[model samples]
Target: MGGPSENPELWAFLESLHLGETLSGTITAIERFGVFVALDDGPNHPVFPGVGFISIPELSWRRFEAASDVVQVGQRVSCEFLQLDTWNLEARLSLRATQPDPFQAFADRNAVGQKLRGHVTKLVPFGVFVQVANGIEGLIHLQELTWTPLKAPSDVVQVGDEVTVVVTQIDRELRRLVLSRRQASPDHL
Candidate 1:
């Protein structure tokens, strides 16, 4: 099939929208992969259901179980224009852009070696997710969970267990926060 370049009208419409600009639209469809939006000002998409598209990751800044948890069909929403999705024949949009990034806010106020207390949110083979702040979860790798040896994170901590952790690394660009429980211990020094 042809791309947006072949459809001059859609191409012009998509190009008219600058990145980070706010666009209003109605949620036309929600799929496992992304959400579709019928832009209030753009032409109808020649292929898809809508001229605007929001990927699953762009739907929210916080973790969610599903797209429906953050938005529903027919919901009027404002999104930040991310780019022209020529491959998908739609304008890529971001709902998360319209909201403050909790991770960024968390990073700005905290630094490495800082101690934080939060409950365990999840356990995995390699690490545990701890919510150090609202909508912000830091990963404590199995090696960092404690100085002791363990076969799994569950061996030491379970979901909802409150624990003190020290921020080990903050990768702002990647939006990752690494934590260490072993260092948080008073005797670690």
Candidate 2:
């Protein structure tokens, strides 16, 4: 065990580990594995001084489909440390874990009956996956794609097509967002 004053560098790092410490760092690189960031200079380097790994679950605001989506070769980001494995020299950082869930933000902005515009990302026999936001996705079921009976969602909407939709239900517990394009344009029904 290291005493605080005896090791100023270690002491500073431990002090900064206190809950709610906000850190800003520059993304040094974005690999298929995860994003690497170098802590802004002071005492603690955002990159963990001598350590080299920052877990993928920490990037803020968006759920990265892949590491590249959330960060590029060079980007600046503010993150909160979730945990540090000093023994292994690993630090877990998070952008989403520290902030309020953005789904709640969407739910707050739009109600069950509110209309929204989204782009269709995929078409399945069961429904279409529309990307409402980078991390947020809403499902438009085949039945909800249109008021009229349809055998497939592709018949009504194709991938990359933008369409208006109405939120029919939001399952916050399950993080499921249910939307209906038919309800928004009932006249077309």
Candidate 3:
């Protein structure tokens, strides 16, 4: 009954929202790709059920098998404005932006050659990605997986394995963390 169509003042207010604005809302809907929030004291969206929207990756810093792990319908949340999607004509918001960046946090607390332990999250042909912290993942390149020449990362460790590693590089601009498992264990060689 109440929406941008019904309230011109709300439409104008929503349209006036600038980038980087913080807004509070109730999660009205959840989709596989994103979450929709009906902003408090705001008008309904012209197309979406809510005026504020958050994409899957923007849901949280930590990886989860399901969106419900990050947010649920009817939950209250605050999000940072990302952009004004001209195509969909909706506000692209980032829920994660409101939260701390685990990647940056890890880097600030760690450095190259520092030893750390983490769980193997994913194993690719090139390397294995390890979860160094809540949402921070570091890659152990195939060459760094072992001191000896290895065929693949899987040969050294499987996914879900807990492994010790040394930080090799931290590219904050690119948000990348390179790690070395071989350097972490010299006695094993």
| Cα-based TM-score, every candidate | 0.91, 0.68, 0.86
Prediction 3 TM-score vs. true: 0.86
- Tens digits of per-residue lDDT, candidate 1, 35-92, equal 9999999999877889999999999999999999999999999999998776777889
* 1-189: candidate 2 lDDT, tens digit per residue: 344544567446644664556667777767665666666643443333322245676665554578776666567777776676555444456766667888878777777888888999889889998888666889998998887899988777899999888989998887789999888888966
Better-scoring candidate (TM-score), 1 or 3 = 1
Best by TM-score: 1
* lDDT over C-alpha atoms for residue 129 of model 3: 97
Clashing pairs in 2: 39-46, 39-47, 58-94, 58-95, 60-95
lDDT of 3 by residue, 1-189 (tens): 355556576557657988899989999999998999898867776668887779998998777887888898999999998886644556788999998887788889998989999999998999999998878889988888887988887777888999999999999888899999989987774
- Deviation in angstroms for 91 in model 3? 2.0
lDDT pick, better of 2 and 3: 3
Which is superior by TM-score, 1 or 2?
1
Off by over 4 Å in 2: 1-16, 41-53, 63-65, 97-102, 131-136, 147-151, 172-175, 185-188
How many collisions between residues are there in candidate 1? 0
Cα error, residue 164 of model 1, in Å, equals: 0.9
Provide the clashing-pair count of each candidate structure: 0, 5, 0
Worst-scoring 10-residue span by lDDT in model 2: 44-53
Query: When superposed on Cα atoms, how far off is each prediction in RMSD?
Result: 2.2, 4.7, 3.1
